[model samples]
Target: MHADTFGTFDDTLASGPRRTPLHALHLRRGARMVPFSGYDMPLHYPAGLLKEHLHTRAGAGLFDVSHMGQIALHADDPADAARALEALIPADILGLRSGRQRYGLLTDAAGGIRDDLMVARFGDRLVLVSYTTLRAPETGADL
Candidate 1:
């Protein structure tokens, strides 16, 4: 309900003053915010991205990737999920080991590309996440 939400950007509706519960917490903890994809996102805290990336590369960064969508399936076993997955994507996703990720491309029945994305098996379910990219979803049909 802040006043800045009503502001116009190039005569179009732009993102307004929205904050996550952690947003206030980050601000309280001296976090810096930046505009990314029309949203006020936290770019860095007292520690910068280079340092954070180095920490992740060296030890652990504990990034806040809550923006990502997480999914899990429980139809059958992992092999079943892989079997269901290979029907759509061109990659041999079934070959992926547990906790491993693989990249694949989506092609039409005629082998025309739609987009490329990654598929990974975390524990029991095959998780898929993509934004504004071509990813072959489960079409529920025999390939």
Candidate 2:
């Protein structure tokens, strides 16, 4: 109950919204729930943001971010994976080194930014993921 209604920033202030599977786990962890961006999410935990941030900086905050936005790729070669990712991004996906990551942007033909996102080579496939989805329709990539 505390996690469900404990903080001024809990986006879960409302009664309904989409929740990831971690919702149950967060509830079990004493996270303060709140509403945000059309979803129910946690604003902070029992220690509060200030302490949580400090602990993280102090190396005492072991974190589990399994519930965060994640994307995976499956391909036979790095080139193949980069090609697949390139189909959606304007960035030179093929230029990224095997273990490196790069920030990518999707832009319209007119040069307007559609979205800003990330792309990385994981294993042999190109993995592109972002918190926001945007697109230029033709390229179908908004980062």
TM-score of each: 0.52, 0.58
Indicate the residue-level lDDT of 57 in model 2. 88
- Each prediction's whole-model lDDT (CA): 0.53, 0.57
Kindly list the per-residue Cα lDDT of model 1 for residues 87-130, writing each as its tens digit.
66777877887778777765677987655545666676544433
Candidate 1, position 70, lDDT: 31
- How displaced is residue 114 in candidate 1, in Å? 5.9
Local accuracy of candidate 2 as per-residue lDDT tens digits, 1-143: 00011112234464667565588888899988886544567888998899999888888664333323335555556677677567666788888876777887656658676666566565555454543311222223122
Deviation (Å) of 107 in candidate 2: 2.4
